[model samples]
Target: MASQNDHFASIDIGSHTIRLLVARSNEKLEIYPLRLERRITRLARNFQEGQTLKTPGIRESLRVLEEYAGILKCHGVSDVACGATGVVRKAGNGEEFLAEVRQKTGIAAEILSETSEALLSAKGVLSVIPRTEGYILSFDLGGSSTEFLLLDTRREKPLWHTSVFIGAATITERFLSEDPPPLEAVSRAVEAIQDALAPVFQAIGSILPAPPTPFPLQVVGTAGTATTLAAMNLKMTDYCPSRINGLPLTENWLTATIEHLVRSTLALRREIPGLEAGREDIIPAGALIVREILRGLKQTHLIVSDAGLLEGLLLDLIEKKYGRPQALVSPLTWRMQKG
Candidate 1:
């Protein structure tokens, strides 16, 4: 069992941003994230012709890692796990970049396989949603990739999983060349998404069993893209997970929201509730991605989950090293650590 004061950490180095989560698992079987931080590094922006981390990207990432290392040391983190996503995995020079990162930070980062990443994201999002019996599909849209997972509640197992290389950031860069993208360009982007998702849809159709009638299939949305959309739908002035998570979003509302987002300018988007400053540039692309996902799944409704990979990593660490405890830990303990 982990001691009351023992600290653990997980870092997710993504294409658009790097996130670090530090948590403490107490003797009472409680795990709380003590500190969380994210920095936008745009690592994938330079991965144009090939999978290579640009010189500026490398320098930025190294600086962030140096700072994060200091923070971990200050907090006395004992067990640490770091992982890289699309940019690193797809880059031709990924191995060399990762080697340098390890040498500099003393943290050997694991590049999570697409399936593994999908599963971890599903596990994390599921943890936050309302427990129910039926099939659930989880979607996580990122900067350089999008992951899909089907979870069978009846069997308590994942049924299917896949990662698509198309994401809001990447798609925006590819299609939104015009200040306000032309209608033709937008249509082309949609067509491209449909083409890319054909295989994923086929895979889902093949593996997912027919659901029992009367119980609608649940679709869960997580990550920055989903959360931001949920926030916009709810008309929040600022992002608040407590207000957004598990909130029901109907298909009609989703469609209307996407249309509204597509028609709005960046300046107008910034005025909308719950849209932060940094997200204005990518919100349109993100909204389009969400709209396509709903269309692909034939989903009529969605449930938003604010939690994802970070929480999943925490749970896995607890279960793997510390045996399951008999008593339940207070949710407040976990809540307090979000700072």
Candidate 2:
């Protein structure tokens, strides 16, 4: 078995960003992060229109991955897992892209299915929150899709999970034409989000008690969209992930933020304290999607989690190498849920 000193790394190549996580485990098998990096390459840019990743997007992703691989090598990472989500899964030429990526970067990028993305995201959130008395519902909003996981500690694993096609990049491309989108564009985007979330709402409503009955639920939000929102809420001149993680954002704040974002021009939004350079255009759609989710799900507040799929990937490596760590093994294992 690998000892406490073993270094490990995880790479998550998503539609809008590429991230890397490097960590080392302690005696108890709990890992501590050494470095976390995110580079916005917009891998899904023009993918819907072109049906293939654009050349500039592919080149940028390769550059980022090559740098990440070098970082892993320098750290002498003993175990590494890399995966691509949403964009790669949808692109018709995704396999060809992956081949070129592997040949250039020496990192095998597995394309994760929607279900796999959901589970990994859940694992990532649970790794941080551990357990909640009531049921926990978490969402990972990506550039191309939003993944959901409902975990009921009373049960063994997640009660249910799903992936909706509505996402920041896709919605922005489909609904909004002008920067600081006009009222009509905003309405269309909101309607699209509602339509996408209808089935999820239906499923949850059927499972929960009728209105006026208090639902035993807590909502958690993960991935880029949620964390970025938390950063913006704090209005930090320099975003600190430590402050963002486990932060609670109220529905009122989310609604207000959406209004602010939708009304602001892309240039103005880019000037926001925590807004990143490349996300100015798509953040309005992302903010709106988050607000609708809070309202539709009857969630008053959302706990923001910075630890997500990358963290989950590291935990999975630990579980596979050593017997499952207590932090990782739920009342129900992920494999059992599949069976």
Candidate 3:
């Protein structure tokens, strides 16, 4: 079991950002976060064409890794786990980049497969909303890929999970050309999303029958895109995770946001009260993805969750470093622990 004040660290290196989370847990089995940091590196900017990580992206990622390494050492972290997703998994030179990162920063980064990404992401959300029940679908929309999990608390694992490459960065690279994005581009983006969602819907149907009548299905949204939209909907000048957690974003609000973003230029979008500065250009595509997902799932609202891959990684480490005390966790969670 983890002793009091033992620190552990986790890093999630994604296409659009590199995030580091440092947390400490005591014997009570409560984990407290010490530090959370994210840097926009745009690692997957043109990955589709190049098939390798761009030199600029690699350099930027290395710099952040080095900075995070120092912070981890300063905290005297007991164990650290770093994982790369999306761009790295697809990049031809991803292994080379990982090696260089390890050499320069002493952080060995593992590339998580799409399945692992979905699993860990589901685990992450489950850790946060332990009380949620009924049918639940959690989606993590990243820059380069989007992951979905059909969650059932009664089950030891996810009912169904999948990852698709039609993410904000990927869609933006493939479709958006103009600053605000032309109507044609926006329509094309939507069409492409519809096509990509076809297979996803088919897979989801295998586990969940399409109800003839509307039913209670909770749609939980996580990761940057979802959290940012929640922040914007709340008109928060500064992002707060506590406020964002369990936030209910209505479908009407999402539709309005997507329309506004599709019509506004990148410069104008940057001026939006709650939109993150570095995320202005990508918001249109990301927002569109969220809107379409809600529509396809026949959901009226999306519950925003700040806890995701990073939090999931931290929880996994804690479980491994300190075996789960059966008394502290529910039986379902205990079964998940076995996995």
lDDT of 1 by residue, 138-163 (tens): 88888888888887776645777888
| TM-score of each model, in listed order | 0.90, 0.92, 0.93
Query: Which clashing pairs does model 3 show?
Result: none
* lDDT for each residue of candidate 2 in 3-59, tens digit (9 for 90 to 100): 867887889999999999888775564566788899999988766833888899899
Top TM-score model: 3
Cα deviation of 3, candidate 2, in Å: 2.3
lDDT, each prediction:
0.76, 0.82, 0.82
Clash pairs (backbone) in predicted model 1: 33-337, 51-91, 51-92, 236-274
Q: What lDDT tens digits, residue by residue, belong to model 3 across residues 74-141?
A: 99898887889888988999999999999999998999988778777766776666465577888999
Q: How far is candidate 2 from the true structure (C-alpha RMSD, Å)?
A: 4.7
Whole-model lDDT for model 3 versus the true structure? Answer: 0.82
Pick the winner on TM-score between candidates 2 and 3: 3
Candidate 1 residue 158 C-alpha distance from true site, Å: 1.3
